[model samples]
Target: MNEQHPPGPAEAPGFWLDTPEHRQWLMSEAERQWTFFAASLRDGPGFFSLDTAGNPLSDDTQELHSTTRLIHAFALGQISGHAGADRIVEHGMAYLRDHHHDAEHGGYLWALRGDAIVDDRKLAYGHVFVLLAGASAKMAGHPDADALITDVSDILDKHYWEEDAGLFADEWNRDWTPFSTYRGMNANMHAVEALLTAYEATGQDVFLSRAGRILEFFTARIAPAENWRLPEHYSQDWEIDRSYAGNPMFRPAGTTPGHSFELGRLLLQFWDLSGRQDRNMPVTARHLIERALKDAWCAHGGLAYTLEFGGKVSASTRFWWPVTEAIGAVAALIKLDRQASDEQWYRKLWTFADTHFIDHIRGGWFPEIDNAGQVTSTIFKGKPDIYHSVQACLFPLTNGLSGHIDDLKHSEPVAMR
Candidate 1:
């Protein structure tokens, strides 16, 4: 609106996926998403959760994941050469360093109320995003990135990484005491993403090796074993805990198709990062992705939230993230195979997202949609952050699994904004 050009769709008849103008449309979409959340800069250091209309919500407690994700998102903006993005990234870096980082405790807090600690538990789920944000910020040349990266990497290695299990432990108390023996696929999945990103930025093989160990446990072992409906909860020994249920919104009892989608994408990235040594990587990724696509996609429109252990729909409520991860997964497939079915599925998913979840008038996507195809926020309040939907638009624009947005300029310049 101000200095930026108005966002507009490409002049195309059919779906944008695999189309000649898709690159341009994707850039436009990225710009729209960035501009929408960039408005959060007005709220200052402790980034406030944004509503669908791009304003700060009434709830002012900023979660650590949200803070790190904003840093990651705005860093992507910086990498892509978005104007005024440095301000956003710098603001986030300052906030993360000042408020969220527990200087004495040696890990980030879970939730903060106006620079005060609310839930101070150090969680791998939140810490991985800290790693991700730091990695992305390092790529963007943020001044504070290296410190954050070193801090989180130390914490993860010392506290969370279990050598026997080859996966991260879920949670710990403030001073690194044992909170629980619980382990989860959700945090490990994101840890893979963060570790891979860290490897990409640092050129460190330890990060790559750690990520591979995790992929071996899940992708090589658990994925095909479970028929690609990846279980969410796990025992301390990394065995599937079929009876465990914690947070319905987070730690659900059944398998999450969204996670399969994420693992599919992350596994492919690991494979590519590993120099494509294992020929089975693509096959495993395809099966996991295709299995999720087949199992969770409703005949009505959007992807279901979670599935029962036997692959029936456990929770039919559609959330924005699964669709975002689905976009990433199918886009990853399109990079290697480019099947017509993948293309069609990609377009179909976008059509559903644009029709239901996207807020054209504002900028952010609605976080949830009910069974009747109406936008609802029963589980999540307002739009959480620009992380998932931003990736849905930006990640697809890159050529390979790495999705280095710094290289986005070399692609076709069709941002008809």
Candidate 2:
């Protein structure tokens, strides 16, 4: 007979993620991931590989979004007193400034292959991450962060922000001559995250105002009108394009349940940041979270990647990022209401993640898993970076979504050692 291991302390009664031991465990796991990525860093102009395990695939192309996320994550590590965190942050910052920056163009390029520009399109999604990285680095006391933040903000305002539409344009050519007619909620959602951080880092009201505008449009108007099933793609005129389907990975067809969960969390964060003035925000957030959970949560385990607007599963495959976002969504609801149902959903999501996504031997999450709870990499392979998983661990441990994790004063002392 096999000997059984006792349930861990995290499974104990009332031992939510905010508990001291759990928070410490999250910090330790974050450090583990940081170390893994740090060891894989490619020097010479400073960039990171796409995957961390087994020969490091996609070592030639460096994605600007991934680079910025790594910078932001490592900056958090730096603030937490991790030893090599600052070095990684510095390396990523140098890469962003020297390599990713388009000298002839106003904005950063999409990706780089060695010294050559590969995908030079200017994307709102990538640009928002640039803002986020700069803000996080600034919070972590990086020397060049202020200048980076200023430059990225200027660029966003000049190219991405649509003053007339009160939203952001999706993409543009390298020279900013040809702008895509496509408008997307994904990029705008990330823009909300970046703008919130920018406001926190600089205390600028303009950033906050812009963030509020995006939130109001999506949460207050669009989500409510659509029965909380937010559309992902839109035309240049901001009309929903039901027929538009781009990349299966990034621009999947149909409504993304993951985005609903993410937008729910961001709405709550924005509401909290705005002094809780918007009474409708918490209500809207709850609806979005519940809609996704009802429609996307796989009957067997995990969540479906995409769903039809009427709550039918579009993509039956499960990915790690959606589950992480669902964890965050329920965590935010728990913070807002402390309802027993919210707590139950939170525990359920964590259980799903631990069972399917977590790689017990490898020390990081698997990026994708099938509905049967078996590991699969049809879309994403080899633990693409720790940004989503680390944040899934960190966000629940915090009191509110204000500023960067480094700047917030946790209710329990963060185990930084």
Alpha-carbon deviation at 249 in model 2, angstroms: 1.2
Query: What TM-score number comes out for model 2?
Result: 0.93
Best by TM-score: 1
User: In model 1, what lDDT does residue 179 have?
Assistant: 94
Q: Compose the digit string of candidate 1's lDDT tens values, residues 1-417.
A: 323322223355443554645666677777778888887775655876787777778888888888888889988887787877888888888888888888897888999888678999999999999999999999989878898899989999999999888889999999888899898999999999999999988888989999999889888898778877788888888888999988998898899999898889999988888898899899999999999999999989899988898899988999988998999899889888878788788877877887788877777789898889898888888778688888888878786887555556454433425
TM-scores, in order shown?
0.94, 0.93
RMSD of each: 2.8, 2.8
Tell me the tens digit of each residue's lDDT in model 2 across 237-330: 8998989899998898889989999889988888888898878888889999999899888779888888777779999988889988898788
Q: Which residue pairs come into collision in candidate 1?
A: none
The list of candidate 1 runs beyond 4 A from truth reads 1-18, 42-44, 409-417
How far residue 265's Cα lies from its native spot in candidate 2, in Å, is 1.1
Residue 388, candidate 1: Cα error in Å is 0.7
